[model samples]
Target: MTTALTLTAAPGPDGVIVLTAAGEIDMSNAEAFAEALTSAVTGATGSRLIVDLTEVHYLDSAGLAALFAQADQIELRTGPLLAPLLEVSGLAELTTVHQA
Candidate 1:
């Protein structure tokens, strides 16, 4: 069964576009995540995009790849649980990862 993922976009300080994501981001829902992220970036009126993953409980390789695909166009805000994974996976080098 496919897991459900929720994504929301809003404007942030300093002309940043923030895309907030919640729920599991596994293979089942990676495409949805990617689409949402793409839409957020493309629809953004700001120069920078910030993806907030504080509410995301899980993210698999597919989800990581989706994020990586857009790393150059976005920054990431993640909780402690996912911070190390992003760092170890070298995604941290492609984009800024803010730990909360």
Candidate 2:
């Protein structure tokens, strides 16, 4: 079954583009996540993109892959639950990860 996922992008106060994701991120909706992320990154232009995943309750490998693809152009903000996975997946090392 497909889970409900929401992605919204907007400019942050720091001048970075913020992509906020809510709900589960798995194979079912990974493509949508990737597409949204890509679009946010592209729109960032000279600034960086900050992917905020604090409201996300689940994220599978497919979601991680989408994140990896844009690692160079983005930073991440996640809750404690998903921070370890980011570290173990090596994504934390590639970019900044702020745990809240």
Candidate 3:
């Protein structure tokens, strides 16, 4: 079983679902993380998602794939994925970059 991920939801000024997650994202917990993120973005009305990975210390292919997949869905909603780590250093250096 994957370790439980923490998700905090607070209403933004524009009523966007601001979910904060802090922990390692890998095969062990990617599914849960993906579910929470996907649901929050898809259900939110603003169609904006800001994933803060500043606290994530580790990530695996599964985690990367999950993020990539979520990014794909967000594109249709005109929502862009804002990732701090994925930006400073692209996920390509890591494994399963083809997913991106």
Identify the candidate with maximal TM-score: 2
Query: Model 3, residue 53: what's the lDDT?
Result: 54
Alpha-carbon RMSD, each predicted model: 1.3, 0.7, 7.5
**TM-score between model 1 and native:** 0.92
Model 1 pairs whose backbones collide = none
- Measured by C-alpha RMSD in angstroms, how accurate is candidate 2? 0.7
Alpha carbon lDDT at 67, candidate 3: 69
User: Where is the poorest 10-residue window by lDDT in model 2?
Assistant: 10-19
**lDDT tens per residue, model 2, 1-100:** 8899999999888778899999999999999999999999999999988999999999999999999999999999999999999999999999999987
Go through the candidates in order and give each one's C-alpha lDDT.
Answer: 0.91, 0.96, 0.57
lDDT of 1 by residue, 44-96 (tens): 74588999999999999999999999999998999998998999999999999
lDDT of 3 by residue, 1-100 (tens): 6755666555557755555666677788888888977887777755565555545667667876776776643321111242444544454233222111
Q: List residue ranges in candidate 2 displaced over 4 A.
A: none
Candidate 3 stretches greater than 4 Å from native: 72-100
Clash count of each predicted structure:
0, 0, 0
TM values, all candidates = 0.92, 0.97, 0.62
User: In model 3, how large is the Cα lDDT of residue 69?
Assistant: 70
